[model samples]
Target: MPARLFAVVFGVLLTPSFLLGQVGGDRLIARISRDDANGDGKLTEAEFTGPRRLFETLDGDGDGVLVIEEAAARLAKVRSNVAKAIENRSEEMGNQSQREAIRRRLQETRGGARARVEPDHENIRYGDHERHVFDVYLAETEADEPAPCMIWIHGGGFRRGDKSEGGLFARSFTENGIHYVTLNYRLSQHAIAPACFEDCARALQTIRYNADKWNIDKTRIAIGGGSAGAGLSQWIAFTPDRADPLADDPVLRESTRVSGIILLNAQTSYDYRWIQEHVPGEAWKGDGLQQLFGYDVDRLDEISDAKFELIEECSPLNHLTADDPPMMLFYRRSSDPEIAEKNAMDGIHHPIFGTELKKKADQLGVGCEVFSVENENDMRVYNQRWTMAVDFLKRQFESVQ
Candidate 1:
């Protein structure tokens, strides 16, 4: 199993006390608790699916049984050791240290899988900006036909993320006969709203302009990402084709329209007013909102009309029409309004975002599927969401063919 998967299972099962205090903790605990085969409110070696060594560690007191309380205490000690190691290191650490550590672990665990298919091209410039670069993983298909392509955008609430994050999906798509491209774009901190959107648009156009060189079927391209990246994908998919025939730049003349889009934990609309009305609680107060729109969130009531219009223009929901491509949305959060109301972060990624978008798609006779984790059964199915998304993309490309 991948180390990230191990982290998820162990994080949920062994650190119950730590997780239970956070958002969706109870649901995560309940999901992992299903592994307790003999159901005496504890997990034994036979019941655990993780590494035996890990199981042994969690089984405190040499009891051969692992309960939540004991596991939590053991995990606390493990955290203390990690903290000490960080302190002993000569390098300085800050807020980003934890994120960097997780990223390093992910890269280490995925090293073998990543080595199977290296990028055919890395850091290909799409625009003049330093961040306007993408990596391409060509499909390993035996056939001579150009492969369908999917461009992935990394999610960091429009503030922080890297193209390296695409490593998670690159192998999966390329092995299945789909060309995968992951790109970096300007974050909200670099420039607001349209700058990030424009960077992505330019990246798509650049890909299409060089389609023949990469053996990519430009007509069958799709876009996807998580969170802020998902919103960017939606923005590109729903908007009118951004092809500029009269533009001076040759790349800009290429069409930006895609066959389909896949969104994971997406915020379909970033309009503060729409979010406040549609999603319960303080969903509008999410990070990067003010930076994205270039407006003061606290002074929204006194904002100029032009700023309000900018918000509408930036929101993917406002761009949706009959011409938009089909979309498959997977949200990790529950659809329950009460759950959304309880946490700001939960509200930001709540399933209501997908439901609202689906409603609009249905009215326009467009294909849209929304999936959310509402219970243990839903959690089980959630593990298959990636496969379902790939199937959805395949169908989309087939339809166009």
Candidate 2:
């Protein structure tokens, strides 16, 4: 083997515990055992094919021969050392921003796998804006009865996400006899608060308008999203029904009432003052705040009363009431105040948002459940939360029926 190829092969063989896993380790060991030229369970220097330096390293006891058992033990030690080095480096270098970036990349990769289940209807326009289009995945149900629907909106702090992010939830919901719809709305770059909110509202109304054709249960619809999208879902769910029965536009006549809502790492309020008061940090100072509200960030201290009214109006918490749909909120961050106050992103998606919302929901006798991960790195718990969200939505639909 060429020096590079030999290095690659040896690298794979040495790190089998980490790179190839247990099954792969077995196969590699078998391959190495085949090189036992003298029918012994060990390889002498004459039989070893890799560099002398590597053989010496694997020998572990300065022995002239490489015993398979000893080599396996050495590999395990190497794997442990590599893992510790990575863990230490991560602890030293991992900041919220870098972690968030890694999370986005992972989501993007998983989002690609989700994209495999193509939409039944793609780019169906609900309004004049280009971003007003939505993709629908009709339920795979056999019954004639209309199926409950779930609409997902993407989150990027109102600036950077795509409706395709909804692909993550498409299969799970559709497989359970529920219709799934994912949509794109105007971002901060396109327009501010009410525009994105109205765009999503219009999309919901449009879906309701085509209820019969899509075999949708208009009354059993639910809305959900993460971060900015979660905030939008709450805005739609908590607000009074926006149906204009006598409107000339038939779509506008459709009710925007949903039976439930799922919020993932959601921000219940967008008002800077409310955020500061509840979140214990400068969450209001996050990027895109100015663009989101169409106000100058530097002049926030002197913001006019009219602009403050707009802020309050856009906040979902302000609109929540006893009559609003039941809600399920999930947060990846811990509820510890000190941790939440450590960074802008943490403060922005703090579990306290859910706690505060649940308190009010309890006061008003509304159904609200908040789940937070004590260990944010545990993906199993993160994934389980989403499973619980789907179950919660199904239960909500069942209750209403």
Best by TM-score: 1
lDDT by residue (tens digit), candidate 1, 100-174:
554444333323233224578999998788999999998987667899999999876787767866765677788
Over 190-213, each residue of candidate 2 has an lDDT whose tens digit, in order, gives 898778989989999999999998
On the 0 to 100 scale, the lDDT of residue 369 in model 2 is: 85
For candidate 1, the lDDT comes to 0.76
Give me the displacement of residue 250 in model 1, in angstroms: 1.1
Question: How close is each model in CA RMSD to the real structure?
Answer: 12.7, 16.8
Whole-model lDDT, model 2: 0.75
Task: Summing lDDT over every window of 10 consecutive residues in candidate 1, give the lowest-scoring window.
Answer: 107-116
Q: How far is candidate 2 from the true structure (C-alpha RMSD, Å)?
A: 16.8
Model 1: lDDT of residue 154:
80
Candidate 2 clash total? 0
lDDT value, residue 200 of candidate 2: 89
